[model samples]
Target: MKLLKGLWIGFWSGLILGLLLKWIQSVTGEQVYTLLLNVDFVPVIGSVQWSEITEFIFHMIIALVIGVVFVYVAKRRNYSFGQLVLISLLMSAPFPFLYFLLSWLAVEAEVPAATDWSAFLYWIFAHLTYALLLPILYKTFERKNAVSQ
Candidate 1:
């Protein structure tokens, strides 16, 4: 049950964030995901450019896990909006930064190099969106559940 709830929150939040980021890219013509998504992984879901599809799936999983963790951390406590915002930013930043840094230093990864500012900024804002949405959606759902119950 917890997993489902988390996944639901994470997946939707991730999707919404992803769309928002895409829109940003479209508008700015900026390569927001230059580092993170530009990889040479074996295509698991798409044609030659499997990264697109795989990346989306990866984000959904990340968001789901973030939500689950939030639920656990949140428990019965009502976090202030600022706290939730901080939580969202904190929740979203580390994994990719570490992953890219480690992969680049440790394994000569084919993904974007660590200094890709555009990608980093995109990553931050994308996570910010996810972070922002996760709580709002989760709280709304929780409130509705409580009302029904």
Candidate 2:
């Protein structure tokens, strides 16, 4: 049940994050998502043009892994939902930086200019959204466990 909750939360959180990022980029005239998509080593195998179905599946898998890991790590630390969310956010901080670095190196693409505050802000917003949603999902699942037992 906990696992199922995690997966469900992950899907919603990931989808929301993706949509929010896309919206922000569209408004700001920045292609932040495109930048991340173009960055190699982010695990998009096969042709660069992945179908929508493939992308959805890949995102869900990634989100599920992140959700499960976050819950497991937080439980191991004996932390509450808020603490787990905070820790997960902190843990995920390196992903964007690594993405930036990899984009700079392997892709030969100039990283989004630091002057582009909108891009950075969009990235932060997306990360925060995912971090915030993850714990809520865990809490909901925990409640189900309590009620069932």
Give me the candidate number with maximum lDDT. Answer: 2
Clashes of 1: 1
The sequence of per-residue lDDT tens digits that candidate 1 reaches over residues 40-105 is 443433234555777677666766777888777665577876776677667766755754553364
Alpha-carbon TM-score of each model against the true structure: 0.68, 0.74
Whole-model lDDT per candidate: 0.64, 0.67
Best-fitting candidate, measured by TM-score?
2
Model 2 CA deviation exceeding 4 Å by range? 39-47, 105-115, 144-149
Residue 106 CA error for candidate 1 (Å)? 13
Q: List the residue pairs that clash in candidate 1.
A: 10-63
- After superposing candidate 1 on the true structure, give the runs of residues whose Cα lies further than 4 Å from its correct spot: 34-36, 41-51, 76-81, 95-120
Looking at candidate 1, what is the lDDT of residue 93?
Answer: 62
